[model samples]
Structures are given as C-alpha cells and as structure tokens.
Target: MEQPFQFKQFLIHQDQCAMKIGTDGVLIGAWTSINENPVSILDIGAGTGVLSLMLAQRCMAEAIDALEIDDKAYEQCVRNFENSSWGDRLFCYHASLEEFADEIDDEYDLIISNPPFYSPSLVSTALQKGENSMSDARKKARFQDAMPFKHLIESVAKLLSKNGRFSVVVPFSEEEQFIKLASESNLFPLRILRVKGSPSSEIKRSLMEFTFSNSKIQSSELIIETTRHLYTEDYINLTKDFYLKM
Candidate 1:
C-alpha cells in the first residue's frame, strides 16, 4: 500500500496523486521566474496542485488555476487547493489542456507545466500494460487530444498575455526538438537550465522558460548532488523549504 500523504510548511496536503510530490516539481517551481508578478497564473497538468500552491506562496497573484485531466488526480488537486492557506486564490479544473485552452477567453500572465513526457513504451506487468494500452487507445480516439509538444507550444503562444512567460520541465533529449517547436510558434527561449545528477554525470532533464519577446537566450547547469550520499548546496537551497529531509 502507498504511504500516507504528508504536508510541508510550503506544501499543502498532497495525497491520492498518482505522481507523488518530488524534486522535479520543486525544481521547476523554484526555477520559474515571476519577473512581472503575474496577476493570473495557470498550471497545466497539475497532478497534485503542488506547483500551483508553490506559486501562490511565492507570488502575490490574484488568481491561480490548476488543470488536471485524470479524475483521481483532479479530485486530489481540488482537495489540496481547498485545504491550502491560499485556498481563496487557488482553483482547479477537471479538464484537459486543449479543452481548457479552448474555453478560456482570457489570456494568462504565466503558464507552467510538468507534462507527460514518456513516449510509447512497453510495460512488464500485465495490469500496467493493460492500463497503458487503454490510455494509448484513448489518445488515438480523440481527434483533439491533449496538445502534443508542438501544439502545446503553439497554444502557449496564443494564450499567453503580452510580456508573459511559459515555463516547463522536459526530458533533456527532447530539448532540441522542443526549442525548435517553440521557435516555430514564435515563442522565444529566454532561459534554460540543464539538470544533472552530479557535476560529472550526464544531463538528465531540462527546465526551460520562454517569453513572447525576442531576447538573448541564457543557459545554465544545475547539479543536484556531488555524490549519492551528498546533496549539492544549490540543490538544497532551491528545495529546502519544501523537502522535509533536505
């Protein structure tokens, strides 16, 4: 059985979310820049509503909306949002990104997502395989499925307010493709941070932030740990507020 959920000072209750609270969410939450003090924010695919809660705590935004497609995750996200100290400012919707984008008339000042990055892959367990197959079948059936990377970038370009920013975490291998896709959609990359397990290890993930305006791209690297037993100072500093054991 899964362990009972826990709450941190900065994090509200986070239970019943298939994707548990983890370092990647914290990294993206901390790394995203809120230069304009966005009045409105959107968290796409907000599994546990952790990212939305973090933004609410970090910035003085007037409204924050979290979107989740999975029924269980959406319900959990709603519970987490309502239980948070900033419950009045936080809200969640049980809808896919495409559906939300289509219905949303007002543009968002900031948008963020830790998207579903896993491509089609085989699973070993029979139950797991069955679930994967069902999800895949569902995807294939929808003419207007949740936006692909290219479509996601395009939608962001259309939905972001002028001078707005979009931040996301994607696999390191997809960085080049994503950059190209964003460029094609007229969203220029403003900043990028390549994440590695350690200083000497290969890059594992990429956290990128983009803006509507054309600007010089800034790139940096983040090393999470020096060794398995030692966490890097920078890593700890970024997530200290959220991680209980950090």
Candidate 2:
C-alpha cells in the first residue's frame, strides 16, 4: 500500500516517488554538516528531493539543486520541490550526475547523495531496463554493469568548491572501499558513524562525511534500538524532529 503524503519538521511532501521517505535519507540529511556555511548545495540521485528539502530547511543556501536520472523519479522530485516552503530555493534537474556535473557552471559548497549500492545481485525483471539505463553504456553492453559509486564520488569531487563537504550513507561492508575510492579523488574522510540495529548486531550501515582537506577523522556508533520495540534515546534524539510518531 502507498503511504500517505506526510510532512515533518525538515521533510515536505514525498509520496509520489518510487522511493518513499526513509530513515537513511533522513539521517544523512540531518547528520550532514555545513562547516563553512555553504552558499550552494547539490543533491545527486535525489529520489524524492528529501535531502535537498532538508538542507533548504536547515541552511540558507542561495541555491539548492537536485538531480535525478530516472524519469519517474525526476518528475516526482520536481513536484516535491515545488510543494515545499523553500520551493524557490530548491530546483530539480532531470539529469544524471555525470551530465549535470559536466554542464553545471558553478561548484557546490556541499554535495550529498544516497547512491544505489546494490551490486552483483539478481535484479527484478520489472526493473531490468531501469537498471540497464543507470549502468554505463559500455559496461551494459559487456554485461558488466554495476552501481557507479566510484563515479558518483569522483563527480562530487569535481563539482565541490574548495573546503566543501561531501556526505553519504552506504552499506557498512562498503565503507572501507568507499573511503579508499574517495581518497583517490582527494576527498578525505572527516567523520563516520556506524549504525547497527541493536547493541549485539553487526553494523549494517555507515554514515560518512568527507571534505576536500585531510582532517582528523572522528568515528562513532549509533545503535537504533535497545530491543525490538524500543528505540534508543540517542536514535530518538537524532530523528525526533523528523519522524511524526517519534
């Protein structure tokens, strides 16, 4: 069943997109810091324009652009942006990160994304064409297409202003690889938070923040729950402003 259109402190209407508003997007949006007080922001692969909206609510950026390659997702993102109070500051570009990075004239003070990371898995038949379109044309032709996490990071590095920040959320297993890739692009890790379901569970996701300069990195853990039905105080504190039922 489709969820109702709901509004939160930092999130606006986001119901029409295939990707509903979720914790991953919310966490990254709220957690990402603007150390230099960015004047411009870019959100790559913005499924429902949630990240951009959050940033708009939190910062007074001159312009906030969201790029989505998928047609349906792009359309929905535009709608979500238009409906928000910060609609004038937020704009949706129906283009992929590669294309946007190439044509955009100005660099961003902050670049963020919740990239597609599923790799070497069985894709559903219904999404085969969409998956193929996301893959590099040459790689798709060779049947070696994979989610382009590296490409995303490299593009971000090119489009970020000096002293800018890049933030993302990826699976815990990919944190090391992601850090290595970002380093190659001259984007060094500044902070990392490992997220686990419970105290005893393995870390399932990592929220990472990087910058153009090499800074002393801070690492920490976030346990979402103390039990199946109970959320940890820290988790609640982090998300209380954005979750309606919290």
Candidate 3:
C-alpha cells in the first residue's frame, strides 16, 4: 500500500498524503473532456496529484494547477508533480479554495475535483472499524465541512473561464443537489457519466462535466467490472491509456 502508483507514463508517490489513489479520481481524470484542448487546467482538492497528472498525460495544457488544503497532501502533490514528465507545467497550491479563489486573477480553461463527500455528523462504515486509524487530514479530505459543495461550486464559478468545462465526481445521490448548486452559479451540465462497481451493482457515483453555456445534456453509464477483478470494456477503454493493467 505504500508503493507509488505507477501509471503508464508517470509515478505518483502518495505515502505522506492522507488520501491514497482511488477509482474516483482516476475516473474523472480519464473521463474529463479534452475535445477543446484547454490551455490551462486546475484540480480542486488534488489528493496525491493523480487527476492533474492524468490530465498532464492526456493533453498539452500549458499550465495545470492543483489546489490541496492539507499540508501533507499538498507537499506530496508537489513532489509528485515535480517528479512527473510535465513538472514545469504542473504546480500544487497549498490553500483553501476560498483562499486560492481570492488571490488568483487568471481563470482555468478546465477545472476538476473528486471532492469531500462524507456527512459531518455521520461516521462512515470504514472509519467505524477504528475511528482513530485515519489521520485528521484524511478525514478532512473526505468530509464536506472541509470544503462544502456550495463553496466548491462558487470557487469553480469564480475561477473557471467562460468557455471552460468543470468536471467532478460525487456520489450518485448527490447529483441533483450538486447540479442545482452548479446551476445557481450559472454552470450547466454538458455531460454526465453514471458509474457502477459492477454490472449488477447499483450506480455508486456520477462523473459529470459542466460549462457556462448549456445545450442538451449528454448522459451515459459506465460499469467498472463484469465481476470482481474483471474489467468491463467500457471501463478499460475509458482508462486504458493511463492504467498499466487496463
């Protein structure tokens, strides 16, 4: 579990970061739209720098910035970026989204996040095993209070370029509320990808893309596996370029 995640073209060291590499970040990173060839990109709550690094591999974005609020995660993210093939173009900013939004004048042609989702009042089943097993920073990485959905959308609205697309991954149950929040900020959905763990499993997450202008919303579903450890064609096709085993 301590080993660096080896992508097809880059290596991510997540030892010090509270949040380790996971499917959610990888899904949004590989599924994010690159049709426009954005010149600049920003990743909010970039744990381990996986999403930013994925984009660095998929497109020639002149600059790719990642914002990580946790100090340990931020430092690890920076080290991961510097050790990557696109070191010069990648950067990690150690600041809250509100703080980062306050100081930056430039807008991102693309914005992304695999954000905090756990309810503040409810303890997660995994954490119940041993509440103290997880670090404080890791807890913040997954909890809404650290960066609530409202603030996340507002930050996206403020920093996203007029024509840019913002991509995010969240629990399926939160999709409508998340969209409503984004709509309030004038960011409308362009695409939605519902994701399931297996063909028979209920949808677990939504991979969404939004922009300032709207048209007909494109919608689809992605099943990650046919069975345990057996990848689906759609999932493998979506991430084959990045994941070595895919």
Candidate 4:
C-alpha cells in the first residue's frame, strides 16, 4: 500500500484522489496571504484538503471549508480533513463551484484555489505532440474545461465577502488572462509572484492575491531552486511551516 504523506502536523492519504499532492498546491497553500486574520476560509477544488489543512496550521481561522467536485476526491478530502489536527475547524463539501455558489449564501473572508491549468488549446497541442501519459481522472482534475476560469472567477466573486481576499496559482502564461477575467468581476490583483523552477528556467507559475478594492499591484519573482534538489532560501522560508524537512 502507498503510505500517507506525512507533514509536520498532518498526514494526507492521496490514493483516492486523481490529483495527488503537488508543488503547486503546496506553494499556493504556503504562499497565500493570511495576515488579515480571516475568520473564515474556503479552499476551492480542494483535492486532498491539503491547502485547508495548511491554513488551519498557519492561522486561527475557526471555519475552514473545502469544495471538491469529484466523487472519490470528495470522499478522500473529507477523510483527510477528519484525519487532520484541526478536524474541528475543517469541513469538506462535495459539490462543484457552481452548485456550491448557488446554494450557499455564506461568504468567506478568505478564499484560495490551485485551479486547473491546462486549457483546451494546450491539451489539444499536447495531444498532437503525443504527450498521452495523463489519465482520464487527471485530465478532469487538470483541465480548464472541467472547471472553466470564467466559472471559477464568477463564483468566487459571489462567494467572497466585501472585504475578503482571494488567492490562486495559475500558469505563468495565464497570468494576464486570469487577471483580466478577475477584473470583469471587480476582483483586482493586489500582489503577484511569478515562480520558476531554477535560475535558468522560464517562469512556469504565478501566485496571485486579489481583493474587491483596487490597490497598487505588488509584483515579485521566486526561483524554487539553485540546482536540482537544492531549494532556494526564499522558497524554504515560505514553505518551512508545513514541509517536514524544510
């Protein structure tokens, strides 16, 4: 049997989840701004409930809710939340963002997501290139068509409190487009962090923070490693709270 992923304060069993725990989820979970002392939080597309678990460890948020659309992933997310130290504060909802947004009237003080990155164009291109290693379940978990960016942003706009903040991680290529989509809902970017694998690698991801009010956009970059397996100091400092070996 595959062993559960052991963190400093929690264990995650990802066998039932299509999208296993990954660096993007960890980065967004650890990189998200929680200094506002948000009383309530919501984790969209919560695969293994890792992001919610991380926030529970980092903040005193009394209510931490997670939304998972897939059947197996939803069950596993609930299990993960129950297995965590903050079980009392964590809850998982098994529903798509659209359904949840339409049914729930409660607004969150903080909302975060590590959303699907592969758009239809990218998927088509990859398929043409014979990059067929991904499974069906993973395609649902990683493809934009499964949870469109427009749908995600619109739901987030409705689900966030007037003073709430939303954070997310997306492909660096999608940064401009994502920001534009968010702006349509009046959600403006407050900060952005572009991430690269190494000093010589092209930017691959973007960590973004958005709010209802307009403000000066703070931009920065993060290079994860100086070389293979050698994590950068900035990366270490950002994620040290959750990673066991950091």
Highest lDDT against the true fold, candidate: 4
Q: How would you order the candidates by lDDT, starting with the best?
A: 4, 3, 1, 2
Give per-residue CA lDDT, model 3, range 53-131, as digits (tens).
9999999999999999788888899999989889999999999899999999999999999998775544565467676
lDDT (C-alpha, whole model) for all candidates:
0.80, 0.79, 0.90, 0.93
Q: TM-score of every model?
A: 0.86, 0.86, 0.95, 0.97
Regions of model 4 farther than 4 Å from truth = none
Top-TM-score candidate index: 4
Model 4, 1-246: lDDT tens digits are 777898888999999888888899999999899889999999999999999999999999999999999999999989988887899999999988989999999999999999888877688877877756888888898889899998999999999999999999999988899999999999999999999999999999999999999999999999999999999999999988878999
Tens-place lDDT per residue, model 1, 42-106, is: 99888888899889988999999888887877887888888778999999988877788788888
- Backbone clashes in model 3, listed as residue pairs: none
List of clashing residue pairs for candidate 1? none
Model 4, position 104, has a per-residue lDDT of 99
Worst 10 residues of 4 by lDDT: 125-134
lDDT of 2 by residue, 1-246 (tens): 455556475444544455667778888988889767899999988878888988888889999989887676788788878777898899989876778878887899999987775644334542575655543422331221333777888899899988888999988977898899999999999999899999999998899999888989999999989999699998888877667777
Clashes of 2: 0
